[model samples]
Target: MKKIRKSKTEQLNFGNYSFEVIKKKIKNIYFRVYPSKGKIIVSAPFSIDSETLNKAILSKSDWLNKQVKKAAIAKPEPVKTYITGEKLLFKGEIYSLYVDYRHTGPRVAKTFDKVIHLKVKPGTDFPQREKIIISWYRKELKRSIGMYIDKWQPRIGVTVNEFNVRKMKTRWGSCNVNAKRIWLNLALIKCAEKFLEYVIVHEMIHLLERKHNARFKSLMDRFIPDWKRLKKELNRFSL
Candidate 1:
């Protein structure tokens, strides 16, 4: 019942990169740039000719090369100081930080107009403030992931035995295919909700396919055709 499906694939050498062009029953041509492997995949309509695809790739060659180079030397995110004027990102939106120390307790809230309100006792050091902010991040990310799990578990025909949120340096999420447990990067709290959902579905899909092979990509295409785009958005954040 999937509306969009891949029909075939063609490989070609274009510009400085060798990539695959996936012919699909889709409306628009799409490109996916991967950060970990510095790979690229292009999906285009079945009717599109090779010359057109070549031109498209050539046009974006420079940007593509930069992305690959960036991926090759990707850096880890530095520890945050959580000071005033620093920005926080949530659900794809930016929130400016405002720290208030007048109150006796530490608090965190997102205002209706797009600002993150942080309140802590005076003289609170970095460690204490970090704990407070991370606690809030975990709580919020958990709530969001729970909803996604509820929505996707049944659809994907999988159950997660355990869900964990932790600080991760290399990956956004991981699935213990044997244990039915999924661990999400704590940093995801700063990403948009769509990417969060994509990661959840990506991990859950592992329950059905253990490898990122053709079958896995096919499943992802069926479940979330826009997953490639979501992955790019998710990795836009460092670390």
Candidate 2:
């Protein structure tokens, strides 16, 4: 990991509860701390005095420590490598991947035993293989979206004017209220059917409530009681 250098005008304050920093930014001086993980990161501008920064971080010591500890306990997802025979979670089950070389363009076919057989050229690199498999997944997602939308529209008492499926980096789904359109992540195909339903329901609910306020939660709860658990499980799988 790269080291985070302290700002020239910043000062570190030590407390029994947590780590914190007082930073002076162009507009203001602020104390920042990662309480859950016990890591305190402060940012300040060039003009702030060290003594003032230190006092600010110390004043928020208790809250800072809590944030640091929480941050510390939070584990990041492990990096994954695309290799032959690796187990991939698909639709709530582990399926072994089989990579083979062929003279044609990259192709993915399923075997009778439920393994995903990816065929690429002998010298193809990891990126090429990933693209091929991802493209196939997108196609599959597009095919399934209509079925779910058809089933859930009437049940939810809402209508989605248009929707599309693609690879998304930040979120699983997004809704365009003005256009009455929804977009879903192709990566969601890896999760279970119920989880996919949750995402669909989530986006559809956006047509009713623009933001994730109390009303949205209530709507989701009324439709799917176990959404939280399903979301956690979905996060466990790779995107």
Candidate 3:
């Protein structure tokens, strides 16, 4: 078995723009721009030298500008202060935030009335409060992901060594075939359960077929007949 190398990352600056360059065991270079945050990420093969990569990226300057301009058309939402009255997204529904002061450690819970109660010690700062909520999201997401993985493993005729949840701006999920691990985005917690299931199944199918070719589509079609509609709806949300 070929051991996967830890991808090397560096910052690349060209003119007025900066890119997060990541070199991985990939065949081709891929550029992804997150318009909501104006973040640019470049993934290239390790065999390619920086000079060639720079030239390739520089050549796409025009395309990058167009994407940036298109993104500018939509106004970005204001930054969240993680205070009361702010909306919290959970399971594809918006909930009003309710902060509860307590002598106990920080925690998060949702009420029957669509309110997310964030319980924290008195005088907990914004960063700490945000961290608490994120921690809660991670735990909840992991539990849900486990349920899906267990439910699909036998059906798909594959087993996963492990799965992880993280904040990803570009992709919802990724599969490390060699590691038998799948990474689910923390953002998926905000989407509907069906959308989350769609992503999970999509990544699981990668174990059978690494590339997204006809065989992959056939597997997806057999497993999720309406995945195309789910994918369309899921993309409407910002990562």
Q: What lDDT tens digits, residue by residue, belong to model 2 across residues 1-239?
A: 99654554323435554334444335565545442343556666666676866676667767765554334323332344556877655554457788888787588877668798888888998887777877887787777788898998998889999999887877889999999899998777776677788899889988889988999989989988988887775564445
Task: State the lDDT of candidate 1 residue by residue for 30-148, as single tens digits.
Answer: 88877555468898999998788888888887878766644543434335788888766666566777888965778898899988888998998888877888899899999999999
- Cand. 2 Cα-lDDT: 0.71
**Candidate with the larger lDDT of 1 and 3:** 3
Q: Kindly provide the TM-score of model 2 when superposed on the true structure, using C-alpha atoms.
A: 0.59
Tens digits of per-residue lDDT for model 3, 1-239: 99878799988898778898899989999988877667789999989987899899889999998655434433233577789999777876678898999998677889999999998899999999989898998999999999999999999999999999999988999999999999999988877799999999999999999998999999999999999998876776677
RMSD to native, candidate 2:
12.0
Clashes of each: 1, 25, 0
| lDDT, model 3 | 0.87
Clashing pairs in 3: none
Best by lDDT: 3
